[model samples]
Target chain A: MSQIKPKSIRQVRAQWDGLFWTTMSVFGVFYLALIIAMLVADFRFTNWSDMTSLLSDARVRFSIWLSLISCTIAAILSLWVAIPTGFLLARLGSESMTQRLGQRSPGCRRLFNWARYFIDTLLDIPIVLPPLVVGISLLVLFQTPVGRWFDQRTGDLFASLGYAGIRGITYEIPAVILAQFTVAAAFAIRTMRNTFEQIDDRPERVAITLGASHYQAFSLVALPQAWRGIVAAFTLAWARSLGEFGPILIFAGTARMKTEVLSTTVYLNFQFGNLRGAVSASLILVTLAIIVLVLTRLITLGGSSNKGVIV
Target chain B: MISVQQLLLRQGDFELSQISFEIPSNAYAILMGATGSGKTTLLESICGLRAIAGGKILMDGDEITRTPPAQRQIGYVPQDSSLFPTMKVHRQIAFGMEVRGFSQTERNQRVEELASSLEITAILDRYPRRLSGGERQRVALARALSFRPRLLCLDEPLSALDGDTRNNLTKLLKKIQQSESVTVLHITHNLEEGIQLGTDHFRLEKGQVRAVVGKDQGGKNTA
Candidate 1:
């Protein structure tokens, strides 16, 4: 009787384990199925002819070129600021501010802590805000008196640099880049900050002790180690910039080919009831995103597996 | 000679106060302390990695308390050997020289010399991740000494190695210290290892430093 009871318990335990795994698999596969369904729907809504027609359209071609150029520029600019900002944040945020400040008065230490907290929160504002809210805020900001004055000064500066006819940044091509950068740079900075945090700072300290200056240590030791992170950040920013639509719409406007981008082209086609054209443009973006993902993986894998050469 | 006087350091609630010590030039000095006793902190302060609240650090009668780490001419190897992961062994060894604007020929010559002396010539082109624990320590040692800093600070460099490797490295350390004629301030928790390599010994306990007098010296404090 006892032996029979034990066997029955074993059977029940196995059944429970099976049920648990089945539940987990159902949850996991649900998301995968949804993504696959989306791709299938996109493919079904458009044909090769629609894709060809979209490519042949000059407006679509202009949108494609502008998307590429603006996204690339925004990504470059994001990296330019993100690298240093990320490094500083990683260093400062990782170490105790009290220790770095050293034996200061309580008031001073409190002030420093508040400042650090404020800056960190400020940096995260764009990330947490809704995309449409970001667009609205930027639109409202440019209409302010101070913003208008600054825009005029920058316009004059650009004119002096031989870029005539750029009266202001609002509703212009530069606004597209600016709007994309406003949000895309935030993501790049966050990615890079995480990257730098993951890396040990001991090598840079060792480099300094070995008579390498701060800049030398950063460039030689830290930067080389961070190459994969840099690539990831750039690709992420580029991808985010490519898909940015809300801010560009509100800030730069549609304007046909002047400030139009791939994302806006998709939106415009959909608004005009050109479902096939919209799906085709979305497919183009999906294809580009896949290419970037593959390239990033290849570059990172190449760096990791390369045995003889330094990255 | 390296000297510290009344060094006061505070991190959060932990503090090390009124610490004073000195090691003669070319001596292998070992610092012994329990975990969290601030041995690493003191080493970092001397290396200019940590800010000292109130203290004077002098090397060869010149005060370098305010000097930047690059100008301090100290070579530091942390507990994990903290090698640059992206650089080949040769490049790691040559990094300091390259950054300091040494000619390519000079950098090459120094790297070769350090690699040969450290018995790491076979692994010059390999990245640090491929190295075993002992090899990593040896490479880190080579890199630190490549630029010929006046002082070498090693924080538990052999702690992570196996017993056999640890014994081998202790002998190698002694041999290299003598051959290179560089002053060393090594931190270790192992008493026997400290005695084996150290010409001068100091112990940190409860935030204060005291010279560890050997039996041969009749228990007289030297610093």
Candidate 2:
């Protein structure tokens, strides 16, 4: 028998490294291949004629328009809330807070810490909850006496403003926007918070010391630096709104040409055995998602390396 | 004159107790401390960025302990010269005046004056990210002095520079201090820096601050 030579440490290490990388690549490529397969399946199932046919349908066109309009409105509202909420959360646990709370009793400090944690967890509830559950919760909430009272007030106000056909918020066109905002705003808030955190707080502090108020410092120093993050947050919110189906299906109810967005259009077509239409709609969403992803990447890469958006 | 009396500050488990110091008007005071000695904390407390547990800060005999930072009219240049990355040098220097509702003409004039004085007029239109380290420090200094604050606080403004740049900036700092006649409290770790620029010297150790007499007086402590 020929004597076998022992493997050198370097050789063994190289072999192990190769095994590790191959295993990792297997798992990574598997997911990527699955995504590609999904796209391929979607494309193979739907032809260009399917797209043109769907576009020809007034209801489908309305769905596309609703999707664009609702997602845009949801994104704008999300940004309105996200910017302030994110800034507050980013500054909440900062060193300045420590100094501010240092003079208080330990109990007070503990209470403040608990409050911060509680608020943070509370904000994350929408992001973590099941999409269907969020819709159900909104439905239930609107059924409550307080919700009904507010809804009645808003309905009367809209009537006074000459939108005589306008009704309450549940299962209406507004419901789609509300449902999308409920979920998308949470993601936007998270993105904005991370964006603010990545930026140096020292500049804001310096601004304050230079005779700028907190609002001035934030608007002038922090807000200007956070534009890329804003873009990322807006794109994420829009993409998320575009894909939001479960909440809309439950809360908004696919009322064709009124509350039916693209997501619901896909489902409505599938329910009616229109596989071609459903697949085409899904392809449209997929294309939009790809565009959003590319845009987010470009924005992130174009940003300053030190304070790029977390998304 | 700027004075911090019996100051107490806390961050997490770290505390600086009964810290007290005073810098005379137009004095170039240097505060020397070890790393993590709460030097920045003390500076921030004085600037109203950080709250103090028990202290009264007086600037020109006015009690400003509870006063907001903006109203305190104190210019602060933090370590790393935290310039606004989005704004060009001109806007960075004009930020304070702009916020205070200065006219466009006045803002332009002030920005131009500070840029000329700081020798950063060449980079006026350039954003901070494009500037060199020394240029950043100069821009920060210019921004701080733009509003002609009565007191200027610098946190290790020269620590990040090389030997030649550090020496040059040190000389510039002295020249600016004299020309502006603004009281300054400069934080540094280099004793040579303290000796070269400081008319009043203080050292922070173990969260306590004590005055260090000048070399002419044998470097004794007035703690």
Candidate 2 lDDT for residue B1: 88
Docking quality category of candidate 1 according to DockQ thresholds: medium
**Can you write out model 1's per-residue Cα lDDT over B61-139, one digit (the tens) per residue?**
9999989988898888999998999899999988878877899999999888888888889999999999999999999
TM-score of each: 0.91, 0.94
Question: Which residue pairs clash within candidate 1?
Answer: none
Q: Model 2: how far is A143 from its true place, Å?
A: 1.5
Q: Write the per-residue lDDT of candidate 1 for residues A25-133, one digit (tens) a residue.
A: 9999999999999999999878999999999999999999999999999999999989999998887766533455665666777787788778878988877888778
Instruction: Please write out the lDDT profile of model 2 over residues A281-310, one tens digit for every residue.
Output: 999899988888887777667675633344
The weakest ten consecutive residues by lDDT in model 1 chain B span B214-223
Tell me the lDDT of candidate 1.
0.87
